[model samples]
Target chain A: MSAQGETPVSRRLSKIKHIVIICSGKGGVGKSSVSVQVALSLYASSPNARVGILDVDLTGPSIPRMLGLDGHPVHQSTDGWVPVYADGGEARLACMSVAFLLKRKDDSVIWRGPKKNAMIRQFLSDVRWGELDYLIIDTPPGTSDEHISLIEHLSPVHSRLSGIVVTTPQAVALLDAMKCVSFTRTVSLPLLGVIENMSGYACPCCGEISNVFSTGGGESMAKRGSIPFLGTLPIDTELVTLLDAAAETEQEDDKPIEDVEHEGFRLLRRYKATSSAKLFGPIVENILSRLSGFTAQ
Target chain B: MIAIQQPLDVPANAPDHCPGTESDLAGKVDACEGCPNQDTCASGQAKSAAQDPTMIPMINERLAGVKRKILVLSGKGGVGKSTFTSQLGWALAADEDVQTGIMDIDICGPSIPTILGISNESIHSSSSGWSPIYVQPNLSAISIGFLLPSQASAVIWRGPKKNGIISQFLRDVDWGDLDWMLVDTPPGTSDEHLSVVRYLKDTVGVDGAVLITTPQEVALQDVRKEIDFCRKVGIPILGLVENMSGFVCPGCKTESQIFKPSTGGAKRLAEEVGIELLGTVPLDPRIGKSADYGVSFLDEYPDSPASQAYLDIIDRLRGILGDK
Candidate 1:
């Protein structure tokens, strides 16, 4: 915070059209996958919607791995830290993560709350987002520390800032996810909706939806709260393999083809074949429609 | 307002050879340089040593009856930390004579109450201290969720407040005589993890920590950090439990790779990190359903593959602990 009533974060983020955060109170509910797919969907919806993802889960940063940008480094410039573009130099999907700061992929970031908060504050204040249409913040599982810091810094963009709660069908996951919805309301951040991830497991051999984890927990929570249900996402083995495979191998050795590039989503070319991209494409379009209404208001 | 505080067992950011905060050389040692708690540990230790040196002794006295203390930890959230804790409690309590206690310190989202099937139970003050809700005659547990007015509400607390509540839980709870005590911690290596090790390390002493993770590079990546966190704080690593290892299709009985283990999952991770791979529990939908319903999946579906796997892991765990 500065004496002039504007933070460096707000000033740096001023160029972004809308910032939506993807959060779930529970971990392993696919927060990272959803964030990545959402970024791809937004960029795929329109070429002009430049996107950036800020991975804030300091202890367990999967965004770098999810986007196949694990070994990528964040370059510091005269303005601040320059985010690594998803592809080569000209791509639109920019990203900043603590994973880039580590020398090894498996290195641990062992810091207490105050230290984690300091890094988070620096992430918020120092990253140069350039001109992003949407900057989706990927948060860890909690309503403490990083979350409080994020809401504090982004308060200036509260109206343009929206929150999306992700959850699964299990009672335990939904039990905590319901609190996530209430948190957005309590903080006065506009609620985009609730997404039920891992709703069911589609068997690879049989091609049958197994109801493995059951379904509809997120929708019921959304219905009870009168919030829009963003639709359920089944456990996509296809999406899992696409991202997981890309994560295992080194990216950036392949030559770029002209024109059909999916900005920010390095793996979106194959991700489109996954059921997640197909399901998320329309969900994002719906969100953008509602977002347009929000901005218009 | 600063009376006296419990010094950290080993602050998270402490150097390799950093002495425990209770040490007279806590803030004075070379390893304590750049430790965030150096200032507080220095002045607080000096004040407590002068004014009241009984704090550690009192905490030690409070936790005296617990025979063994273990922490269930995972660096990533929602990786079945609470589920494993609850099931471990049930498995230990399966014996008619063994008494077990579970302490859930995941303040922001205390799902232990829900997972233990005690979501409706509330903590009560007893003559001795706070009475933990007994789910069974042998199994008892406590969580901040029990203190909440409703399960639907979020505990929007900051770190200091979380630490305060954790301290109070330790000081006020009468765990009584128990054969086993399992503390389920929230994900990440931060305030709660440090606080648990801080209060319990020098007092009753943590026997070890059971690391849990799904078979994925991302989850494995975090578990490695957890391994480091335990090593840094001097907590012995019991082993790692791989939950959601692979999903076995109920229809075809064919196991599918829900989370592809591109980096060889926890098996390779454990081998690489030089820790024991206790066991991998395959994904069973009934396990999640049971946890949500707050019942013992081990009891309901003992014949199932997941249950047997859990039993085998528990047997290995008992053997490992028994020899020690």
Candidate 2:
């Protein structure tokens, strides 16, 4: 094994106690939504606990829009690049994404592997994530350049790093999701467990849970693979409204979601009222329990 | 400050902190000492440099049998790229005389096999090249899923491995005499995108790309980037299709915007970008069910409005590519 010495990346990431990679081999399975909700849940669990979300889904970054931190930009400090906070500046949750550096938010990244790798390295080495209790890295949906870059940079922090695999409930999703589990196994990244996001649809009007995508496929995959199946997160339209309310209430009478001040509390507060948020509570507890096993040397 | 180039292409085996393959000092740099792709990089296989001009004619000759190819792309995932490819395969192959194929280049998530009802089929490569799994008498398909030892096994490959397979899929796959081929890509303009576009664009011309998006602004935002990617690469835009436009309750018969288009959705985006709005398919739960079952959604739900919309769009696409 390569010596796990203090490399530049590990030196920077050392302050972050727990590093969780939220990933899947499949796309459109609500990885971003899960990452945001998990961050919100962590912050809500302990408002003072510092959390950071590094959105490495470079070509298709959705974290800013989901968090309603659309117009915020990263600033260069003397020490390093300062991340934008999801809440206010003093808030515990910080975020760094390629989306923050875009000249125009909607411009196509159009970069290939080497460029993406350099950016990922810079993100790991340059972001000044001061003393985070937890830092969740949301990844793109492939096993290519970005994933490789992340694995290389985070290797030294292996003991502190694990992965939370997200998947929808359909067989096609499960088939692809199994590969993600396999990748984690190959890389020897500790498993935090699997999350079955988009498991079902929570109909707002009817107040019933429908198996729109399906249910329990994640559990079966987990059982077969012998990894922990954290839990199922239904398709909550209410939460969708919160994440995308910028568009929903864009032209309406009320102030748009992103424009409102005290942004973090409002969004996190409303997110707490969501069914997904309610379910994520136990999931976080499971994560916390698993992390507690690691001695903080 | 590290430079991020336009359409940068680097092999997966390149060493860490390696100057990009497109760099003038590519393989000559210190990092290249033991890299596997060092010699290739030094020889200028780097795409943007376009040093080896023979690559185009070679790929063109390899793909000469393919008449017209279309790529189904969305910068966002789970928006039904594979599902659309399956339906398009079935629709195009409806005429038995027409030889149609769907190339699943999503690599890590090759959902086409499962969606096309061939999840159990493994590929067979011969001296001629790899033989595609026949989905129908006329419709054939290829995917890394088929090449996997098991459907659940992960490829876990980086850019170089992906690029190599994509090159083989285009140059070596024996897709004999395909009339219409639909290339399904994963969400992003990364390795697979650059490789496929370069191979096809430099060779036989691509028909264009059919962009997919949901009604929400978040999804549409990515579609704009996908369009930009296409424009930058010089791939023509066929049109845009708004999927999951709305959901109709089986009981109330009322339409609801499940993924509401806050800023007019794809319709507004099409108008703003001066691209045609091919069609919009409302959210039908059965579409997911059909894809999960590995059956043709258009065939199973022919009477449904979504099916009708799909047929209409297929007709329009054929019309656009008909003269060729």
Candidate 3:
């Protein structure tokens, strides 16, 4: 209660608006990409807004890569955390992860729970996140130490959290998403909505929409739970390509050559221009409708 | 010396003030003595009493009213420890003779308050100390999760903090005497586990540690390490639960191992470690579904196979403890 370990630093950093967390039951559910798109959408919609993303997936942090922010140096200031700029200072976003701490890029995070919790608290306290529109968090799949600690650290402000449960269309994915959703309720956190990613796959050659993982599960879950159903996303090869290219071009101005296979570059460019309308419009609308008076953008 | 225990309701104005820093409150007992309610508020007295080593008056005063202290532990994560703990706690609480209290030492993964459907309970600290939220009529529970502000809030504490919390949970929460106190520890043999073992070893001997593991080779491999840790620490290994041993198809009632159905892991390890194999929990999707809704399968589907497994485990545990 004295906030001994938390210190005055965490006190200063606690003031922020709408901390939205992106979660998945299992890996490969595009949890990171969905988090990136949501943050980007929030950022683009409000130029004055400050949006930061914390990658809690120590071993597999993909936010920097998907946001095209790989290999960018993040330096700390006395006031708060300052994310190294990407695209030649075009965007200033605060990003921190165990991935950022490793001496080399490929080194694994071989830490236990207490150590993991310390780093998470450090990220919350030390980082000068500044007042922001949304602090998008990317959690590791399944309920692990990092995920549990993230919730514990944020519990004092559970009312402010809008948890977004992400999952693929598969039954196993839904099962995991339900566990994540239950975890939210267990911790007494508010249920924002559920996003079913990879709902359907559109084959590039055939231009047909096929239910690869079994569509409509996430929406049904949302309906059953009486929470908002934040629309579903189809499997687009172009989107995957856009993400890959974005990862490569995020930190630097590395332009992809025409001859090279970089679908991420082309798709993400188009995706960006109409992101508000295409990627996040329905989801945002659903969230706003459920929340009533609370609208981010 | 078995005595019937009555439920003690927490007073409306029982000490609602959160204990300040441990150092600040260390010598402030005389200041709190002026309050009308000193019995519960005087945990500082209980802490001093605990230092007596042989004076189990602290344990007797605290747990004399509580029936069983069922400690649930896991060798590692993803072994269905929380799920099993939730189910077992509900089953015991459902019995009239058995009042239940779950102390989740999985400070990092305190999922019980949500799993048992009490995540919204406001944890108020009274002049008496911290008040635990009641999940059932005779069942009360407490965890850092319940103490947290949100499900996403992380408890970042070191050794001293962890030790203080374990002691606070044991002494502060008003777990009125009656039935059982199920403790869900974080997976692995680490600081939290050591803290619990050390506390119980010094005070009341840990009744027993329920070791849960999945049938997977990876999970079983971790179980061996846990067994060795228990031996090193002199903590009693009660029994083994093979969770997700096989998934029972809801449609046909046919059981199959979704993650490798073989019981080689539990059987071989239990034999090697010389612990009883309690039972195998089927890979029932309903258990996972119930867990997601914060409902235990035992509460939702008492007649289900998963529920039965939990009941059998509890019965076996009762036999072990009662015999001793």
Candidate 4:
């Protein structure tokens, strides 16, 4: 299979230890945000683990902006094009997205099937991701061309390729998310678990938790389907604001801060600490444990 | 190649066991090797074997009757593209003389059929093409949802297949002389968007697009890209509709910001993009209930704020299309 026409991509991905794909059947379910947070959490938890995030949501590339690496371009090297690197606390995280190649941030990519397929192929094969512990891919919604292409491209190269289905706590979303679960099963991709995003909203002023769309749908869906339930992420307005601000900040030289005296940054820092401690922390731990179990096997 | 010892004059409607069957000439056409028209006959047979030779022309002829095409698009998913489309169809069909048709191009998660309460009916095909399921006398609809075997079945297809089916929906569906054709596309500026715009614009010029978004930065952020898509493709922007702007409690009737905007909401985004803000729809619980039960909220709760907003939006849209 490596000697086939897909040799370049399969050979390129052969170096990665694990490739985890985050997907959902429905759009606007915070799938991209979950992918970003999961990658960040993985980097924060592992001391020496090398992580890379590949935003394959070509038409709606959000990872570049979400992680403050929007305008960064891909640099060419002898091996291939090197991915852009951003400091993730103690570890360095590599990122790649088609957004960086666009002339404008608002430029829409109106591409057809063959062109998109070629682009995804180039993204997989041309990006020189040097020995990494994890390569997390963020795909657009639905179990269509992009999802099938990614699974087929990565499964032959990496044995540890798995999928994490993201969903909101609504029956409509769950109904579609179930198709994502079935998609993974049909493709024979390993199921890491399911993460229910925007499960509940915690009031920023009074700290009262409200079920924005009803909370237990995701957990029940996971249980009914016999898949592992990762955890639920509360709808944090402060986190949304912080991420938006981070994307807008133009300073490329800005380093990760331990503690800031500025009021807004301080609040952002506090929110990150609390939210990760409460939500993303456990989710990342469960994912890492699953990967470790797979490695052991 | 197999040698053909049989005659070339085979009857078109001959029985299976007839002397010179059609199947016998399939590969045994080597006998016509010296004939001048052999190339033409072989090529014609190949074309016919593939599929109908007039698929594109058939689609063009079918859509030639549609006066205006308005695509309902959004960059972000789950922003109620289908629900809004269903409501807009109902609203437009309220006029006794107006004729409206909806083409659900969201092949993967086709919710239009279910939302419009026509999911149980299967599409019927004629010599012309597949006939659209009529939700009302004046309002007809078509969706991939109606073609599925069951509600649990999923359409796991690639780009080319989806494109082909979407083209068929436009060309093959029998939508005759529609005053307005609302095309509901999947989220993002990808395959479905490109296909719908190409087919509709090439057949009959598209009127424009109606963008939908929520009053949240997360949704508005992606909708900005959608607006960019419309501009790049040369599709005029009719306006933007902000759905679920605020949630109205049924008990207290007080509007509260459920998904508050971190980035100044849709109105600010519209201002930044230089487009008109058509209307804002409050998050009414009744809308969801009606949508789930496959009924029209405007007809059930005409006095509700959300329904009223839809009416206002419909009026503005009619003004733009000059349908009034």
Instruction: Give the best candidate by TM-score.
Output: 1
Best by lDDT: 2
lDDT of 4 by residue, B93-175 (tens): 99878899999988777778778888799988887778999989999999887877666455666676677678768766888
- The stretch of ten residues in a row with the least summed lDDT in candidate 2 chain B is B1-10
Candidate 4: pairs in clash:
B59-B171
CAPRI class assigned to model 3: incorrect
- Candidate 1, B141-192: lDDT as tens digits: 9898888767777766567667766776777788888999999999988888
Quote each prediction's TM-score.
0.90, 0.88, 0.51, 0.84
- Give fnat for candidate 2: 0.62
Question: What local lDDT score does residue B79 receive in model 3, on the 0 to 100 scale?
Answer: 65
Best by DockQ: 1
lDDT of 3 at A118: 84
User: Which tens-of-lDDT digit does each residue in A24-118 have in candidate 3?
Assistant: 65555667778877766665554465677888765446566555655567775767666544323434355666555655543334445678778
Rank order by DockQ, top first? 1, 2, 4, 3
Tell me the spans in candidate 1 whose CA falls farther than 4 Å from its real position.
A1-4, A248-253, A257-266, B1-54
Model 2, range A113-145, lDDT digits (tens) per residue? Answer: 889999999999999998999999999997777
On the 0 to 100 scale, the lDDT of residue B138 in model 1 is 88
lDDT of 4: 0.76
**In candidate 2, which residue pairs clash?**
A28-B77, B12-B160
